[model samples]
Target: MTNKPTILIIYTGGTIGMIKDYSTNALKAFDFSQIVQKIPELQQLNCTIKSISFKEPIDSSNMNTSYYVAIAEMIENNYDTFDGFVVLTGSDTMSYIASALSFMLENLTKPIIFTGSQLPIGDLRTDAKENLITSIEIAAARKNGQPIICEVCLYFEYKLYRGNRTTKISAEHFEAFASMNYPPLAESGVHLNFNEHHLYVPKNYQKKLIVRKKLETNVVILKLFPGITQAVVASILSIKNLKGVVLETYGAGNAPNEQWFLTLLKNAIKKGIKIINVTQCSGGSVILGHYDTSVGLKEIGVIGGLDITTETAIAKLMYLLSENLSDDEFSSYFNKSMRGELTNR
Candidate 1:
């Protein structure tokens, strides 16, 4: 084997891996076998590169638990062989996919850097080259013969954010992601300046990585809006096989103090449905019992999801639900930052 750090580039399908035919002008997937030739800049990096792709590349809309499990297994299978991994996928559902992987893998000792571009690789002003090259460099970065980033992260634009804490805030710009709750772990500029203070280091790096493949998918996002009727709320809570709900609430997890709303949530919790309160705003934390409106939620056992995006809330719920944790265990774990997803006040 080689002595240089080895980075496995996983192309899971996205605009970043596409090119346009000169004659037909139709965009098509680029053959990653020629990745080195396609992006000659990679040859300059101090790392050995390898690549693998899905048998059938899928768009982000079609991303699901099956693919999440497949990606997790692939990393698990190659955990010992590679020093780091760079995963590329569509930006549309990247937050969800990245958040899911954050919970799926445990005790990570190497970087799992997720990145994608808003434009195709072959476009004149495409952002793909920088994102891809920087991600590889970040993944391969090490200190004292050990990896620097030991958790899942998404590198976009010029910032690197914790995977579970990121959200896609832009649909048309190269800067497509934002992590409101936490500062960026690294920023790319003249030099790759990493905020070493913010990096995640596992409690014990020697612990064998644990793969949590079982994620309960019977979950729904119930966003609250003015004029939302009791009928809509009732219908959702009454969904067959529904086990978890990501309740997107107003500022600070405030909900209408109306009797109908509180009673419905209370009844659902009594029926064993796990409902979590996450703020709808891009930033800030949920402080239950801070306001009169949220007092009922706290008393009714609606778990408070402090500083977690709806994407992370859903993933955390799915992961905890599959653990068969008791009511107390579920609430305890959900409120705390299991993988730097949230902050406890």
Candidate 2:
């Protein structure tokens, strides 16, 4: 006889787990274990679900490295017991959390689907039910008894996206997430249609999952604007113990060509600070040497961020900075895609 696949739901405090009070008209956290009773559609799924939540729910804006480590450890403790995992977090920082998890969990062979809703689960027209139910279905989906999705993913609005590639692009719409650089891994219509070619497959199925706990948070994002003053750049680079900078530049990674601008960045790089050139535009790769304005950046040892999103760039920078690699090694690793976070050149 075939046994049902077991899934673990890790709720890290988000709108999806909230319910309303008719008397006070206030919102409060609800019991996720009673989800099956509230939403009977979950009961129709063929898999068994077990839920665990944080002691005190937090807003996504308050998410930090400590929480990231806790979530990874939770999965590590139950990796062998559960067939898959569905993590629920606030949509505001869902992309950042998802991207961090993608890098933290190496050699992963089972699905880790991150999802959340724009509205409360108890709302009359809430999107939580669809997002939660579909995420579980995708996590439990299998072929020939092997899990079909073997990577970290974000499921929202009937579309499944690679966790590292997704970004929260909307707030008022049901479709709140988008993976502009990559295509949807799967879609929900009359039936679930999966793009198998885009799915990640582990080379060694017998290998165990590796969970990384040490992450450095001494990083800052420097966004360049038309009137970005030299004072602003100097203030950002002068931060104490700053190890990395995600430089959000103009189109195709072009930055100001002024001598002072170039000098500030050049001196920063000389002081062992890693600066990554990522595009400020929502969609496109950073071609450092393709334009006149960007040539100075290429000459100053600024690493091109390629098509990596700012959220993924931040997570990748933090993860790599903890390794304490050499300058050459850091640049080499950053250029290459470590978990499908960016397109390899």
- List the pairs of residues colliding in candidate 2: none
| lDDT for each residue of candidate 2 in 1-345, tens digit (9 for 90 to 100) | 137989999999988889999799999997987878888999899999899998888889999999999999999999999999999999999999999999999999999999999999999999999999999999999998889999999999999999999889998899999999999999998899999999898888789899988898999999888999999999999999999999999999999899999999999999999999999888989998999999999999999999999999999999999988999999999999889889997
| Candidates' RMSD to native | 1.0, 1.1
lDDT of 1 at 281: 95
Per-residue accuracy of model 1 over 68-101 as CA lDDT, tens digit each: 9988988999899999999999999999999999
Q: How far is 197's C-alpha from truth in model 1 (Å)? A: 0.9
Quote model 2's TM-score.
0.98
Q: TM-scores of the models, in the given order? A: 0.98, 0.98
